[model samples]
Target: MRSVSIKELLTGKQLLQEITVNGWVRTFRSNRFIALNDGSTLHNIQCVVDFEKFDDAILKHVNTGAALKITGTLVESQGKGQSVEIQVRDIFVHGGADPEVYPIQPKKHSLEFLREKAHLRVRTNTFSAVMRVRSALAFAIHQYFRDNGFYYFHAPIITGSDAEGAGEMFRVTTLDEKNPPLKEDGTVDFKEDFFGKETNLTVSGQLEAEAYAMALGKVYTFGPTFRAENSNTSRHLAEFWMIEPEMAFYDLDANMDLAEDFIKYVIRYVLDHCEEDLKFLETRLLDEEKTKPQAERSEMALIEKLKFITDNNFKRVTYTEAIEILRNSSPNKKKKFQYLIDEWGADLQSEHERYLVEKHFKCPVILFDYPAKIKAFYMRLNEDGKTVRAMDILFPGIGEIVGGSQREERLDVLKQKMAALDIPEEELWWYLDLRKFGTAVHSGFGLGFERLVLFATGMGNIRDVIPFPRTPQNAEF
Candidate 1:
């Protein structure tokens, strides 16, 4: 007999064949049937054991959370939920999880309790399904880029320059903590540090990706990005994954088109491949929403929300138009908006983005032409002078799912912008060199990988979607 995966044995065409399988026991009922799962599928295989034939010692060891290797003949199940099961011929205990001490019992536990047990949470159905969908989404991302003529570029995790221009970063150093090098001005001298200068975890891979995009025509970086922002909200993470794709010779319009198409394609891929997992998450979300107020409940279920992305075209609206809509809308007029939009040039918040997507547009909305002062220094200056060619794709719950802009390729203009922002030219000399040598119309966007996984899994907390969440005062796992 050959060892077979539970996933295959559940759906495969090998009936009545004796097979060997290794898995953890999910549940043992009536001292005769064993629920076995090998992390291969969400569903468990019911191994019907002949209690009379089995030794009492072996039967006593078959308990929930125990790791077992079983030789069984695959046969059609008489159970309602599953189509197939295993008729156990033999059982061997590889490991045994004590029922009294094993934390993960076969029951519905709160996400909070599960998060505390992050190390062993995957044994649960919810997290396993989420992780499975996450894996599929990641694979789909690479596949999409590869099929679209994009090269994968790995950006350095430790960077000398702050790409986001936000000073928050986890300083990387190998200097003495109490007494080491000190500048004459009473500041810690970074000049004598490991890198011979100050360095921190990268906030983004876009700048490096831009360099490769100028040469390779299209490139993408999917890696962990760090931020030291002290946010304890459900959406914030100190460390998270980012998918930033840069394309040379692509204007803002083309960038938006690519983003919409790419998001839809990946979502559709997951919907097609992870039907069982997605269905479970959908039911989970429905149960979760049942406790919330009617007004606050989700208008669509989990899979319905995923289908919403693939079935409908994203609505494109300018920042100016979005501002006008928000200003005239009931939320602003009734003073319901926490941050009122009374004037132009005000940075739009999550509420504003959601209003436009969920309330105003009732679909995904692409908002473009943001004010220059509110955007980054690299975005191309529009002809109107007050705006840059920046665009943000907003989803129903996620305020900004994607942010991109046509980069300012003009060497003189880029230098002027850098000078105004007080960003040292030497710090990014290589970046400036791109503009000098072969700069072209290029654009890219950074999509938080956790955010995508969260949205796809209908998960409310960003921490739950990511395997090991790095947050303020929390890095236990």
Candidate 2:
């Protein structure tokens, strides 16, 4: 008998075939039935085992968290609820899990409680479904870029300069924390560090990915990026994965197209392949009534929205226009924003972005040409001399999922921008050299991988979608 995937069993027509499955028991109901998941799919395989045939001693050891190998005959379920089931004939206990100590039980547990047992949370139905959706979305990301002729580039983790220029970085050093080297000016001597410079974890891979794109014509980097930001919100994470795609001979419009298409592709793939898991998440994770038909809830709405994005074109709006709309729509002059975006030059807050995408646009909106003073130095300055060629893709539920812009290809303009921003020119010599030698018009964007996972699974928090979330003040497991 060959092993069959749970998804295959659910979708396939053949029944009464002998199969073998190896997995940890999610739950043992009534001491005669078991719910098994092999991590193959989000849906668990329900097995009906007769304790009379098996030894009572052996059955006693098969607890909730035990690993087991079951040889069973698959049969079309005649039960009123389930579609398929397996009748077990032989059972082998591979590992035993004590019921008293296992963190995950058959009953309901809070998300905060599950976060504490991050190591074992995947055994639960919600986490299992989330992980499956996460895996599918990640695969879709790679497929989208690869199909479009994008070369995947691996960027360095430990870097000399902060790529985001945000000054939030976790220093990488070998010096003793208690007795650090001192300079003549009575400051810490960064030159004596392990890297012999002020090295920190990479905040973004865009700078390095740009170099490869300029050489290779089209390149993308997908890897872990670290941020030392202290604000612990549901959306923020200390360590997360980012997908950055850089294209040569491309501008802001082309970049937005790629971002939109990439998001649509991933969403479509996950919805198509992980239907069972999506259903599980829709029922359990989102807290929607399980009695309602699976298609009735907002998951269908999300699917419809994604299909709309995939089939139709995205709406483009300038930042100035968006600000004007916001100002006109609100009667109160001093309306309190979460991040306080009161003026035109200030950065857009999540509240403002959500309002525009959710209420005004009613679809994914690509807002471009933001104030240059608020954006990074690499973005190309527009003709107005005030706004830069930066764009942010905001979705209804998730705001600013993708951030990218056209690079300042001209050497003199880039140098001037860097000088105006007060960034050290010596540190970016190699980056500037690309422009001096043979830099063509190029653009790229960084898509937060966890955010994409959150969007795909409809998972609310950023911590739930990631396997081992590294958030501020939380690195357990």
Residue 177 CA displacement from its true place in model 1, Å: 1.0
What does candidate 2 score in Cα RMSD to the true structure? 3.2
**Prediction RMSDs, each to the true structure:** 1.1, 3.2
- What is the Å distance of residue 302 in model 1 from its true position? 1.3
Return the TM-score for each candidate structure: 0.98, 0.93
TM-score of 2: 0.93
lDDT of predicted model 2: 0.84
Q: What ranges in model 2 sit over 4 Å off?
A: 12-14, 285-301, 331-342
Q: Please write out the lDDT profile of model 2 over residues 1-477, one tens digit for every residue.
A: 677777677764658888888888888888888888788876677899887899988898788889998998888776655688889999989989999998787889987899889999988878888887888888888898889999999999999977788999998999989999999998889888887888899999899999999889999999999999997888999999999999999998888888887888888898788887777665564464354576444534445545655665668999999888776655224665555555688677777887787677777789999999899999998988999999998876677888999988999999999898788889999999999888899999998999888877777689988989998889978
Candidate achieving the largest TM-score: 1
Q: After superposing candidate 1, which stretches have Cα over 4 Å from the reference? A: none
Instruction: Please report how far candidate 2 places residue 434 from its true position, in Å.
Output: 0.9
Clashes of 1: 0
Give the least accurate 10-residue stretch of model 1, judged by summed lDDT: 1-10
